[model samples]
Target: MRTTLYGQFVAGTKTDEVKQIVDKFKQYNVKVILDYSMESDISTSITASNNVHKSSFNTELDESNTFKIYHPDERIFNTNMFNYIKNSNTSRELCGQSSFIAMKITALVRPLVLQKLNQFLESRITDHNLFDTIDSLLTTKNDFTHSLTPNELGEISNLLLRINRIIQTVKKNEGRIFIDAEQSYFQTAINKIVIHLQRLYNRNNLLVYNTYQCYKK
Candidate 1:
């Protein structure tokens, strides 16, 4: 049953299986866009401090249906993505062309952190010192009253490191990556991450592309 369901939509669940599928597509001159469909496990949560005002924004989610405030294990997601890129690179080497990998930023960073960061970015979008503000947030070890907690800041830094690793790996292997867009609520944060990556990787040409889901608008 599981095989029948996912087979229709996904390439494959295993690395070897997916690689075989990509190889088959190569025979038809069709390139593959590999995506790890684990982003649905990502969820939003409300801290105890925010519970007082949760009613105002409908921030409370069903506890049983959601993971913890932040997804406790990001390494699993990172490893999966890294392996996908490595495998895709190997396939590309055999095919002598670029293979695309799509990433959803929500899978790397918690939704709550993104929500807070997005709020900050939205309020300061037009500020002259916007990049400076981002730099400060990324480097600051202490939590300001209006800023993220120390733990959340650390997580964000770790996320950036992991993302940079993926970007560097793709660049080294002569491949490209696409950042997949999600709902409008999260688009600002997603765009910020993609822009950061573009500035780093899209130097000579457009190696990284951000998907614009026009249907949402």
Candidate 2:
């Protein structure tokens, strides 16, 4: 499957469930560098009732984000969902096919903790509402989020704590994790977090990998 990091890492999807995929690939007998389709967003609701949100985030892209009002078709990639997956399951623990069975982190965690963490991240550090950021473009809007100014430092503490937790978990597990490249708007902040995480977990081992995306003239 052409999975994103969100799917494979965050959602804890079953590699066993994709036995057909594994079998097909095994035919070549080469190797696999798998990516996941689920992200922290997958943590939202996996039950039958949550299919609406699942379908949208998992398969479809829409013009819903504040930035999309200007950069329509832009993908926000749902931080809450990504955070949900990262915080939910254990990289070290899980049982299934041996691909992950012969694995490392070998731990397990609930999805709720991740949901709470991302909620904290979404609110306190990354709390600005959609309308607030794009108030000028909005025709009819109440000024609830406007009064709150950005708290640069406070905005990062939630992320800082979360990143620390991720590094600790990954190191404790001996697993490799990757961070997808992001748009330039978030490059500075994301890079800072990655650097901090690398120092803590990957000083000796290459546990964390980052994608490099560039703009061409």
Clashing pairs in 1: none
Give me candidate 2's TM-score against the actual structure. 0.42
1-217, model 2: which lDDT tens digit per residue?
A: 4455654433335635444455565678733333433333223323422433422332222334222111111132224323434432332333112122111110111122223323433444544343232212122223223422122122233334434455555555555666654434344334444555566666786877665667635
Looking at model 1, which ten-residue stretch has the lowest summed lDDT?
54-63
Model 2 residue 177 lDDT? 64
lDDT of 2 at 99: 20
Once fitted onto the true fold, the runs of candidate 1 whose alpha carbons sit more than 4 angstroms away are 1-5, 40-71, 75-81, 84-95, 132-144
RMSD of every prediction: 7.5, 14.2
lDDT of each: 0.64, 0.37
What is the per-residue lDDT of model 1 for residues 50-139, given as tens digits with 9 covering 90 to 100? Answer: 434422332222234332222344445456556656655764564454666777777677667777777766766776455543456575
